[model samples]
Target: MMRTFPFGTAALLMLFCSIVSGAWLGLHPAAQKQADLTFWTFTKIHYDPYTETIPTFEQQHHCKVDLQLVDTRAVTSRLQAAMLSDVDVPDLVEIPIDFAPAFFRGPLEHVGFIDLTQRIHQAGLWDKMVQARFAPYTSRGHIFGLPHDVHPVQLAYRSDIFAQEGVDVSKIKTWDDFIRIGRKLTIPNKRYMLELYDFRSAHLEACMFQRGGGYFDPQGHCIFDNDIGVQTMLWFVPLVAGPHKIAGSIGSGQILTQAVEDGYFLCLVCPDWRSKSIEKDIPRMAGKMKLMPLPAVTANSRHTSTWGGTMLGITRHCKNPDLAWQLALHLYLNKKELGKRYEGTNILPALRAAWSEPSFSQPRPYWCNQPIGALYAKLAPDVPFQYTSPFIATAKDKLGEALVACVQYYNANGDNGFEPFVRATLKEKADQVRALAARNPY
Candidate 1:
């Protein structure tokens, strides 16, 4: 009775059951898992724009995104640690120009960021973007990140104060003319012509860039003691110290805003982003400020400089690089998205195609209806190229030290032998930088 069923029949029965199961499973397939991506930015303002726009990317790609807002110092530290440990890393990150050099310290193949040069060219974006803006994110001829903005610097002056003092800023084409007119407006501690922090090198760096001078040459060699560097430092020291002082330290935060309100400073070195900050921080300054091209070192020199900058790059650990690259293109190259960001940040897009957005040409009441965006766009093409290196920050700090020393020398010795002293001081600083570079050859 137990052997009653034939062997062939039993085998056929089992095969039929397996076929049925396979067909049924094919009709009701398992759900596909959704992809996940994480993004990190150092500033909340930078994070907000992506938050508003990333939903579109998620819907199209059928993925989820997690956005993080980390502080500047923490962002740098966490990124470095993650790169070293290969754990808990974001797929995409926003790197400030000041922090970009550190990531480039390693050999090309070992760099944390993906090499995007071929992708950029393949996407036809290499020619679509402002070519000079890529300098900060490039290393050894390999591009790693897409530039975030063209931070062209200009002169933001209190138009009301300038008019009241009968100073014609239009004639101020060169630094000499600026100083001549500034002398009449400068009143020592009461009111100063402009702001130049003696202890900080930002303003000085901008001026040097304007004259096509910087901490390092294109070959990544230290050139802080070159002719252009020496000339800029000599001209800059007298304005912040000695008898020719026409600049003052206006501090920051409430102190800066209060100084603007109290007319403690007449002019400021305004980059594109700083204009927006001025709008938000000092609301009462609306319609009272006007922008002009920065006075050049010479009539033939560039009239504009650059200040802060940022870039977005895909990390080497990204699980979905294709998706990340698409997202970057959406955030940086799409005119509508860039327009939305510019409305809040007043940053000029590095993508040349986005410059034609109406938002850029719109006259805002905050800046005396000056079409602030248009003004910056005119200078964007001329913004100088800034080279990056691991020693750039250190070189800048050394220049700051040299500035302090030169100021001290001017204060005690006046203008006598000032050039020689500055030359010697900068040479000594340059030598120190060379020594450090030798110890850490990259």
Candidate 2:
């Protein structure tokens, strides 16, 4: 026995109820109209670029993007948790090369990431992006991420020290030459020709990569005990051991800063990103550093190696994959935005077209007035394709342990046993990784 309202009265009552519900829920008209997107990244260095483009994109797409900056470790932990819980997941995330392979190793449909293969091909981005940057993010037959930068490895030497030591860069073209010059620069206890941070064997790996060797082949098989790898280990063993130590380990943080500032290292193996950090950390060493192509394994090696990079990926939780892809493209694929990112962060653009910018040609006084960008540009195209499997991160740890152990053995025994020991250790580690890969899915 309810009283029925007239047509106009009922319509007015319904509208009033809608307004009340909206107000109660704290949902304004503008808020309801905007599509919200969440982006998680490890660095706020990307904020400026996002600030520039996101607003424009929001206006055009009627979407609001919220960027969350988190710690590197936190990014992976949170991403994994969110995926597991299926709640509070970001629409986009930045994955590094070292961690990307693990994610990409699984089937694309089963992983938390979206497959970007068709979109990349259709947008013509496949040809425009740095080809080598795609390696770590490709799995099975699908590409899962868009490359954010090219991290070509280079040798940054103290120019003043090299000149003082009569170590001519032009003549030291091969690894043998580099080692000879390094031996000459060694002064027993006070200083060494190079420095090693107590991190992973990035320096050694960079050398191995330049020699066309890596932890695994493109087919995801371990090849670290191959001829090239054996040769690399043989060379690395002596440099870190005995009375003829050309490289000394400097633990990270303030000690590393102090070492670099105190001029304990004549040369440092640097990636493009590392070059930026040197300028930021050891400002006192300004104008003393210089960039050179990596010392080749052979006199005629045509390629260089790369280290450390990031890739922008869309998560499976994205409500609008199309828009998320658009945002990623705006941030990284657009030449203008790429140029801005480079200017702001010294992030070497993965887009080949962006390399022609005038800044790439400009000389910087920070590195003895070297055209750093141009040199990196030349090296970028030649960076060899490096592949990693899911076991890569653990494999790196094992390899580092082997490296430390080899150095300790030599330092203790003073015997010519390091090469054989390193070879055996590398083989053992390779077997471990292979067995792990076989047992693990994908």
Candidate 3:
């Protein structure tokens, strides 16, 4: 009944833009009415900083920034609409990893972003950026865009319950240990130790990443159906079905988001970004939240999966393209300003140098102020960045459908059981990705 990832759709983009029409007129359009620079950004304090940061650039080099604030989801459609209308385009824009590949074609390509591959290399942070870029955006042979920080989850379980259940998480290292802990703590009518919902894919993929399944291969092959992926999902999906009685079956849907916010559920595998979201939205679970590295595959193989965040990009369209580039790079690449934005906005910084700061390494007032960031910050260096395949988007939709069907199939026949549904669900979707990969050769 829920919608899937709509990668290419223009309608969804429009819907997103429409939602952000109010609560601001933060632009300095009046001051820079004659400005030659135009930078388009999504609605966020992090993006807005570029606008404010430009005065320093302006003071130094006499130029004005004409920044257009937009919602992230609306970026693609607005650009597409601009092309069809042949309207003026901004000089700089922040396209998240999901929409970057689509912009690789058309007007963007014609008057496209200043490819900073050389500049990045010149800055000498290319290798460090490359190390973190996979979590932020998928890159190709040529580094496409700058990386923001990665959003990785730590297992935040109820410590009180763990103590009550005699579960020592420090000793419980494997996936099996996690299950045993989850099962022992699940007190049916009293509490659900784990809430596997529609959004459970985030957790599932995290597990898959621990087992070495990634979004794509360096050669861009589809490996979702690889044995590691199957086994990882098999470990949790069945446990959530019934006997284990994990929270009622909800995949990552809107309802589940609300449910988690309400504290209806106790434990969740949450990303760092959620720290801010929960503090604001779910005040009930504030101090109780505790962190753990994602439960490991071989215990000591602490490698974990991370969901990526946003990055900055310069559009090839401005009247002063080079000026735009300087400002974009200055704001994103600056360590001091990046740290300010990182701590204040709950937005992490992309500058690799920023991580070495005492601020990042130390425990915090928020997030239990644990030194967890330093530990979970090491992203897999070789994640496949070439996400340009046309079928990747479709596969996301189909995968959502497959997840939904599993829920329906199990709910209908929980007795006859999971093998029938699991086999039918995974193989069909997995084969589609494999076949698509073969044809496109990603």
Choose the strongest candidate by TM-score. Answer: 1
Enumerate residue pairs that collide in model 1. none
Q: Which 10-residue window of candidate 2 scores lowest in summed lDDT?
A: 26-35
For each candidate, the alpha-carbon lDDT, in order, equals: 0.88, 0.80, 0.59
Per-model TM-score, in order, reads 0.91, 0.88, 0.78
Q: Could you tell me which 10 consecutive residues in candidate 3 have the lowest summed lDDT?
A: 380-389
* CA displacement after TM-score superposition, residue 188 of candidate 3 (Å): 3.2
* Native-to-model Cα distance after best TM-score fit, residue 271 in candidate 3, in Å: 1.8
Clash count, candidate 2: 0
Over 274-391, each residue of candidate 1 has an lDDT whose tens digit, in order, gives 9988898989998899999999888877889999899898999999999889888888988988987898999999998788899999999987899989899999999998987778
Better of 2 and 3 by lDDT: 2
> Which of candidates 1 and 2 is the stronger one according to lDDT?
1
lDDT, candidate 3, at 434? 77
lDDT of 3: 0.59
Clashing pairs in 2: none
